[model samples]
Target: MMLIVTGYMYVEPSSITEFVEDLQKLAITARQRDGNLSYDAAMDDPHAGRLLIAERWRDQAALTAHLHSSDTVAFVGRWGDAMRGEILKYDARRERGLMDE
Candidate 1:
């Protein structure tokens, strides 16, 4: 089953700009990974310093691998406490486009 992961994190307001920039780069790289179906990192509330992320993976193993990938680890480590946040995962059994018939 596909896996969907979503979450939000609070970062130092001053760092929000750079964080989002770097996150977008990471998302682009992740999408090219073996099992990454999609990846997104965006600012949900700039004033509140809330950053949002939504990722889709082929399975648990793929997700785990991505989590441990060097690039991912480096990105998260760079932000450290400033971006620490909660993430939740779910099994995505199926999906469809809004206009799909």
Candidate 2:
């Protein structure tokens, strides 16, 4: 099963640029991981300092590897104070898509 990880983050206005840069690095590292399926980040259009991250992994093990990686620790360190909310995870199964048709 794919693991879906979503995060709703609020960054300090001053750290927004740095936070984004950090996310880009993390994304690069995630893509190189064996279990990574997809990792995307986007900012909220209407809300300043608000951002969202969505990730899909091949399985729990892959996601676990990502969470335990040094990149993840560094990413967290860079954004720890800027983070406002919780990171959420869910087990996902694709229910409908072009392939399903």
Candidate 3:
């Protein structure tokens, strides 16, 4: 099954710019990884210090591999202290066309 992960990061106001730069680099690397379907990050409009990330993977195995990737590990170790966040993941089971319903 495909996996979809989404979340928000609450960063220190002073660190927001740096966080964004790092996140962009991470996203680029993630997109080039095997089984990575998509990776994106955006600043929340109503929240000054909040950034949102959404990712899609081919399957649980792919997601697991991503979690263990060196880039991912380094990113966490490097910027973990600059932000706080939660991630939620879901398995996609079915899809239907709008006209089907």
Best candidate per lDDT, number? 1
My TM-score estimates for the predictions, one after another, are 0.88, 0.84, 0.89
Please list the residue runs of candidate 2 whose C-alpha ends up more than 4 Å from where it truly belongs after superposition: 45-47, 98-101
Please give the lDDT score at residue 35 for candidate 3: 92
Residue 36 lDDT in candidate 1 = 92
Whole-structure CA lDDT of model 1? 0.87
| Better model by TM-score: candidate 2 vs candidate 3 | 3
> Residue 17 in model 2: shift from native, Å?
1.0
lDDT of 3 by residue, 44-93 (tens): 94246887889999999888998999999999999888778887999887
Clashes of 1: 0
Each candidate's number of clashing pairs is 0, 0, 0
lDDT of 2 by residue, 3-53 (tens): 888987788777777878888888988898998989998887324678887
**How should the candidates be ordered by TM-score, best one leading?**
3, 1, 2
Q: Supply candidate 2's per-residue lDDT for 98.
A: 69
- TM-score of model 1 (CA atoms): 0.88
For each candidate, the alpha-carbon lDDT, in order, equals 0.87, 0.82, 0.86
Top candidate (TM-score) = 3
The sequence of per-residue lDDT tens digits that candidate 1 reaches over residues 5-49 is 999988888888998888888888899989998898777899988
